[model samples]
Target: MKSGVLKKSGTNKKKAIECLQDTTKNTIVFKIKSNYFNENYIPSSNTRATTNFANLARGENRQENLRNTIQMINNRFNSLAKWDNPNDDRYSVELEIISVEIDIDGSGTTFPSIEVLKTHINDHKTGKRIEGIVGNNFSSYVRDYDFSVLLSEHNKGKENYSIPDNFGELHGNIFKCFVKSEAYKKNFTKAPVICLSVSSNKIYNRTGNHHPVLGFEYLSSKSSLTEEYFEKMGLKVRYFIPPNSVAPFAFYFSGDLLADYTNLELISTISTMETFQKIYRPEIYNANAVAGQCYNPSLKNQDHSLTKISYDREERTGLGIEQGKFAEQHFITPNKNFLEQWSANFTM
Candidate 1:
């Protein structure tokens, strides 16, 4: 059994390397910018910050928001997602920004736009890029998660619960443009995973459940509408609330990539989520109130002007309840079955 596991690992490693090589060949590599502003972290003054969907919206400071969020995510992975091997090594994922050429007729649409950015694994630490780490990308809007409109449509009833017709078309085009890119051809022997993070409070179905469920279940159901469109194009979908995360993130891939995750990898992912919660979003973890502080962009001497923001528990749906519930349901509760079968594989 040990030898068989080793052989399977070897095979997976080979496939991963091939995928990485293909990715490198196709991807438009840009040097990682040293500063936040250069990396599109700061938003322009004209950008509008609104509160219609504070939990769901990406806000006017979209780049800054992403910078802060990704920073927390990266830090979480680095700090908590470690492997207790001979070297006591740590694992991390790298995110790269890539632009896809697509024509948008911005006549008078108030909807958010989608951007193509890919997530890659750092090969040196992970050993193989494709096995534990795969090419995952996300489609996000320029200004918001577009939940205000989405929720309104969802309230129209189950028939309209799926992504809006126009929104679906836009995403379809984005995927079409992505597949045509040289990067897509080189990096992916199969379809890359697509992740979506959005607000879930109002979008969820609150009735007819044997047990209480988070709004994510409803949101995932809605996303299934889009998933079907993608599946017809040859992709598979998996949606989850990242452990300790308030926002909804959906992952789409070509095959059973998520199913192949080891128990340790899942634990590491959850550890990252918990770490993120402890720092950026403490309310969910039932921890001390933590606030995020940053230099005010408006000030010329930005370093001197610090702006602190606290996440309000009242404003969010789950607060301290959902994350732990998710962790219990997905990880701890299922561990009994996992342990019964793969007890020896839990070395990490």
Candidate 2:
């Protein structure tokens, strides 16, 4: 099986603690509950050519969201490839997606633990694999199990229901284990870039530019756990509103998220993430006075800022309890059978 569980119970604890130290070679580890590895000691083998990074949001209308995300990707590619689109074909390059459910062990009633989506990107004319981007669409069985279940039990019945000081450490380490596997080494040529929504807490502003980047002038008082978690992962975060995009997106990467990738490769991720944001939070992306405004010759404002406001949050905490309950009912609970099967079958 792809799931790699160490057989020796005692060594598991040692291995878990060892992961807490500072990384030696582009690897970062952080403190988490020791018991986290007691049962799930080893990480998944990830033998399949896939990545756990997913930009999708939780809730109903998920399939529709996926379809829309694909359309956006094609549209964005065509826009960016004007030279390649003189005749206005379907796209300058096409990204087709295929997905399969990881039944964690195949015992789930019908719903799998999670689904993995892989995109095949090719040049429209040559039909050659030119863009090196694929593997998206992972569900939150890992999130549900790690955060909602394990973390809950770890801090259960505490006074004020206190959580550990290392709130995001466990998930981050598990994620590290996932990416560093031999399968990942075998599959890809570079480190992964994960794209997701910008913080609802901050108003993003962008300077008008043909090539884009974040204008992070308006600093916030505190960092979100999401920001801290990625920091612990040794990843740098940048926010950008892609050309013709409605809102900004938070991109986490070990290297330059922009420079490390080809234009079409980069656009593939941006399009998927931006479409995902628009679908899940219409109030944030669509139901507003503006989508993405391109200001005429951006000039320094009163605060000496070069950018203008793009989005601000009302009350949507991306990690709120309501979101958890929804995913648990729709995705996790139905896939419990698979988790059990996976647990029993796991071994070194």
Candidate 3:
């Protein structure tokens, strides 16, 4: 089915335009109130701890921690030394953060909402905003997730049990709201991208003997309903786990941005089996891990292959953290086949 905003009323157009104008100014980072992360809230015993920067919300320094994490992502992507696309003259990619707040009522219902709060362009050596589209505005949600059973189930295991039935519909509504706004049509007529960093403990690799492949859950399940819906709107989706990142992030984009190979290059450069092993359970990414095992979503009987690469000791040992860890990491080293496959699979 199709996704994104479908209705275009005069009032909606006016509001969207206003939102776009308000966000496009010189503002870089927008900070939310501290109360947004309530200390009183606690997760149930059954719920597993969230990975990556998502865990920052539980601590007292939620804002600072998340900001630091985002800054790292920004710095890594903007580094020209790390990304040199031989296909294009552009040597760098710039990204911005657009923080949005979504409110969940006491009954655990997520109010379909988003607000563009901050935008940060990466630091480039040229000291000028690199031409062309400067990547996406990192949109983040500003509410806790303990109360929602749907979120808990989808987020806290070796495999996602199920996604919210309306997950795709909500994203569709949000996309509609975003596109209707003036900023989207005027500046991002090509369609903007949304990058989300969240937990992926439940996503496992079926072919690697059930070894946890990063972001596998989102791609293989009904949880991908939102992504499928977005694809119908001519957008593309990609997911990856950064080195030492407990959770993986999803990127949705359109136009030339979708064709750009920078995101995957950066991710592969920074990530290693050891890093993933440390963040997730070691048993998953370890060298001795077996192959052919798979994870079956309780709701769906089908099985999804985790990775084409075997996770045997030889393969696992070959992936050393030091290989790609350098300030001036290798450029022109992205996996082209992987990129093409991902783009084809997610783009309708």
Candidate 4:
């Protein structure tokens, strides 16, 4: 779907987001707009994170998905740690999904919808390393509901749509409301920053950068709905393929993502995103080398050779969709009334 606002759907309910354009068309970042808000409200823990960073809300087969997702998380941790022998515990990286309660409904009713990652890392002698933490790809649920579902659905059927004059403003405002919600304020210390894989179909030319960060320019167009939506979320996008990594990752955040996160956190995300990238976008990450005259990439027209990693990534795509639909049905769809309350009442 187009970026500024999503395509419309079967339902014609004039709910919260439909009016978002009119109510908050010129809003900016929550941190920037708020006169008295803490930048680091919840300081980054020296150990595992609060799970507020990227959480999974409830689902229909909630217990089952939770169990499977946790297993996936543990597997990801093990694969990245190179725990070749699953039976052996000499070297292990573990993640436990602990329940967190929050009022997501906007109404007074609470949902045990949030889950935090409690980590336990072992290195032969080093028993306890990180305390607790954790991703978009790694999320138990789709955290960017507005960006992924709401806006995308809103713009679906339109063939010749003009991005609103205040596209950034409107989009950012919706996110701003989400960030400033009471549940968010209570659960998170700082504002949110997340990462997404660059589209495989979009051709991106590598830009000059001395560090691990490899800048990229869209070979097709300067801006995309994804780019603008993220900018409105208060971050600029840059691609980075860290030292000794297989592929480039697009991180969206304000200031510097590398600087903003701790070394362990960075390692965790690299393990999460790069591994999945290696699986899902194998043409790029798994490529022996970029083919053709230009050393650049067209991931769809890829050159790939699978590397050593267990677990069937191809099988998990369906699970990802199921998880998303579950989150949308349980978390986002039911919350429309709340979002409406949010949209009509929100201010710049």
Candidate 5:
């Protein structure tokens, strides 16, 4: 009676693991070959970025090449478009990164430190803890968008797009985030739905370089303007800790607990919490919140449903407004009474 064997004598289908990979290699940030670069061109620390930049210097069709390069960059940016799969209900996580600003001293003095920090939620929550490793750790991210919501100016989605895999064991600056299911669901939500993964065991060690290097680099806990900005906005600082390579640390916030905000927003608020703190403090990233999805549970079974409504007229504007409003106003706050009032009156 080996594990995974069906009770009825001979079935071989395995029981699915409760957990799934939320990020994929394609979703995580990485450099791909630019067609402009010569076929043999291999970028490196010794080779100046201009060397690669100059690769696009063509003579007659230089304009065309420039246009193509611009388009290439645009395409990459747009590639983060929210996608949903039509099969699994559980496959509903989006990918996003905490916006961070850092001052890297190219003059060869010291490691780059975070200078500014900004996040998806700025007004509602301020000076909170931020998760994820910063400052020369193994993490990767990319920018993506979703069009399910109608307000072009605001660009509020039903959920905060983020991959849900955490690789705390990796010791180097390079790691991979992977996505598995194309299956997505939409029903007038604001964000895309996809699962992502953070995988580490695969290491790529470069020779001669003392500090570790990989296909990509991950930095954790570097300070950013996001924290200072949040503090300016009136959000309170909860936890602050110095960055550590071996220990776990994170920022936390307590908002008026409302039923409307999705679990994802709450999670991301914490994820970006450390970035909002005025003091440097060590914090532990919450594991459970990072693994959850932020879509409207009722709409998790539909594909192209959000897109369909998005193209429609009257239905699109007012659609999903309740969730959108909740997501916008209540990410991280300290008002428990307000949350109680809203929950008592919530009709939907």
Candidate 6:
């Protein structure tokens, strides 16, 4: 499994401690809850099974939770049906966070500078900027080459670019960053494994480790529409502080998180791959993984699989959610066929 900010058990508890100290103004204590599915501390002997970090770190239930989260969100949007034409039976919506983490600062007895949080939330909503909230003493995660490359490519074509490959190396780097960080790294061995099976090569095994680095930004208006986005739908943002750590967290910086475009990205996997741009899953395309494999490692194969699967093509739908780099984008619209395909797997 790729390293994460959340640990299983018998792991260090410093990061959580530091985070609580920074975020909670009043004296408060927090408990670290491991994801419910984590079972068995030791690894099995099977090579593939041992390597399947997604399966190993997070068992079936946790993965099901994430899948259900996406599924439920899409279902709720379909029920609302305001985003599309009433006549159009097909409708789908993509759900992703603006990606923000609260950095705890020890010694200082206060939450993130209200100004900084306000500015970050504003920047995220306006699609103008994204800044990491790192404490003065907090160290920055050294980004790998692939991580930087994916960001540059995704952000290149537009005034404000979005990372195209979510499941690629970008997610890996972010996980490592969180792992390496002094604040959140403790207690967590790696990020949660949400889903699995996107590239389909069996080369890359874990889900959350390869998940696209999702950014979470606050809504411009805390009014009904935005509040409803979370409150009514159970689309709540994940907020927590690492345990046993100090106060005064650090804020990292990034402009790539600011995505200003008419087109809200559903999933960039398709578009990015079409252009022959690099992807996080080099393993899938790697000479060894693709060489004489059962499925030809190409778009032709993907199209065939997609057709056979017969699922929603409009909304963000796919198997296996990757982390580091974004993948190809799949855009869906209002149509009965679209809605049917999206909900098809749900009842089953």
> In order, what lDDT does every prediction score?
0.34, 0.43, 0.32, 0.43, 0.22, 0.24
> Which candidate achieves the best TM-score against the true structure?
2
State every prediction's TM-score relative to the real structure.
0.40, 0.55, 0.37, 0.53, 0.17, 0.22
Q: Which ten-residue region of model 2 has the weakest summed lDDT?
A: 31-40
| Candidate 2 lDDT by residue in tens digits, 1-348 | 222111222233222221221232232222111111111122233211122212222235434444455555566666656565676443533332322122222232122222233344556676676644543333333454455555677778776765566555534543555456443444456676766665765545554444542322122344665677677556667666655554556677777765777766776565555544554445444333343442211111122211111122322333323334444565446645643443333221
Pick by lDDT: 1 or 4, better one? 4
lDDT for 319 (candidate 6): 18
Write one digit per residue (lDDT tens) for candidate 3, span 251-291.
56665532453444333223322232322233333223232
lDDT by residue (tens digit), candidate 6, 206-247 = 112111222221111123222222222112222111111111
Candidate 1 residue 12 C-alpha distance from true site, Å: 38
Candidate 4 off by > 4 Å: 1-92, 96-128, 131-133, 136-192, 201-203, 212-221, 290-299, 307-338
Candidate 3 backbone collisions, by pair: 5-176, 16-181, 16-182, 17-182, 157-202, 158-202, 206-294, 209-293
Candidate 3 vs. true structure, TM-score:
0.37
How many clashes in each candidate? 4, 0, 8, 16, 61, 79
Q: What is candidate 4's lDDT per residue for 1-348, written digit by digit as tens?
A: 111111122233221121112333432111111111012122111111212222121224334433444444445554444434455333434443333223332233332332333344545545546632232332334344444445555578988654544443533545555555543454344445455666654555544453533222223345667777667656677766555554566766665665665544454555445554564467776677632212344556445775433234443444444444555675557665654455556674
Deviating ranges (above 4 Å) for candidate 2:
1-69, 90-118, 134-138, 146-163, 205-221, 287-348
lDDT of predicted model 1: 0.34
Candidate 5 residues 1-348, lDDT tens each?
111111121123121111121222111121111121222223222111112122233345545543543333223222222133122221111212211111111121111111111123211123333321211111111110011222332433536543222211110111111111121111112221111111121112212212111111222333333333223222222221112211122231223222323433433322233221111111112111111111111112222111000122233234334323332232213223433343333221
Q: What is the C-alpha RMSD of each candidate to the true structure, in Å?
A: 18.7, 12.7, 17.2, 11.7, 25.7, 24.0
- What local lDDT does model 5 show for residue 224? 32
Candidate ranking (TM-score, best to worst): 2, 4, 1, 3, 6, 5
